[model samples]
Target: MNYTLTPLGDRAIVIELGNEITIATHNLVQSVVAFLDQHPFDWITEYIPAFTTVTIFYNPLLVLPKTNQTTSASPYEHVVNELIPYLDNLEENHSELGRTIEIPVCYGGELGPDLPYVAEYHNLSEEQIVDLHSKGDYLVYMIGFAPGFPYIGGMPEDLATPRKDNPRLKIPAGSVGIAGNQTGVYPIETPGGWQLIGRTPLPLFDPELEPPTLLKTGDVIRFKPITKQEFDSYKEDKA
Candidate 1:
């Protein structure tokens, strides 16, 4: 319950769980989210949790505004005052493991244009590069950049590489790329600089669905290498 609450304009309050990014901090954030999701404040509209922070979006008018206080309070202050008691008495357990998700990927060739470049840069064979990447047990730290695009961590340090010097005008949706210490799948066709390593045939984002994004914060991903024929087969099956 030791956390700092900060105002974000008129409708949002960001809960700073800790100063550093760690599993313990993320665990606390998720615990709070689980509690509030079931017993949410009537004014609250959104709950967005990241590596070590949680942002609460609420309606200003819906919360009780105090008139007797010496200083006027914004919606942020109103929420802080109302939610402080629950924050103090909660029990947060950090030992629980995240849910594991298996993702199928087709590396090299047309699916991964920069696969050779990454292998050459690392002084490793294409097979070695793929092995290093797929072997790591990656965690979904947060979902950012494009919608449903998860900013994942725990990539093998040897596979670390800087973003492209000149970013491509458009990267195909489902393109998997490594940027520094993290790796992510491009959920939609957009400009990007991450070194493209492979492509997942999985449909990551579909707005019509109840939950559009295939992944969420705290989910663990294990990449299963797939052949081009299998990737094409997946697409055909989905179609």
Candidate 2:
């Protein structure tokens, strides 16, 4: 995917990281970061990644205009030209950024009222559904919408289901769910529309923890089905 750098005034260029936020694109983001750091452009500040793009924040007041640079040569143009060559030649790197966390979840019961419905909709037994979800390796694409909310990829196509027509008032935290092509865990109890197949008792977002987010971008997540008894025990320990 190609990048388009837009000048946000004299200070910063927003690098648009197009629609490739998979493991393949992880290297692209890191390469950009490494290059930017080495170049030492005072104007560039932060590089934020979303599902499809990376927004580069910059500080213009600090970076003076080049002595020989003309008004026609914008910082965005200069940065993009310098960056593309590096990105083009660099191989896509897939570094192990985070651990594969196996989260234990309990399916069905009050915690997952829609579990049966989802299975029925897909014409599969509840056990089959659980096995499919548990077996897949999910990649954490981006963290957004809520704190520690991971937008996971790698869900089985057969298990793909639409979200609830109407969102619930209070979705308990540690909810494991799917919406369209993506699957994720709700870090905190809040309103949501994702199809709830199970609930993990793990605290996904712990403010008291050194890193509040239980997972981050580039981490791999897999759900392990456990009995309600196990779920209860884990929740109690967290408390």
Using lDDT as the measure, the top candidate is 1
What lDDT score belongs to each candidate, Candidate 1 first? 0.87, 0.76
lDDT of 2 by residue, 134-189 (tens): 99788877788999998888899998899999998888888888888778889988
lDDT for each residue of candidate 1 in 1-239, tens digit (9 for 90 to 100): 78888888888898889877787887898888887877888899888888888899998877754455445776567799888988887787755768998999999999999999999999999999999999878888788877888878788889988899999999999999988877889889999898998999998899988789899888899999999999999999999
- Model 2 has an lDDT value of 0.76
Candidate 1 yields a Cα-based lDDT of 0.87
- Clashing residue pairs in candidate 2 (N, C-alpha, C atoms within 3 angstroms): 11-60, 43-59
Local error of candidate 2 at 154, Å?
A: 0.3
TM agreement with the true structure for every prediction: 0.94, 0.81
Please list the residue runs of candidate 1 whose C-alpha ends up more than 4 Å from where it truly belongs after superposition: 65-74
Question: For all the candidates, what are their Cα RMSDs to the real structure?
Answer: 2.1, 3.5
Please give the range of 10 consecutive residues that has the lowest summed lDDT in model 2: 60-69
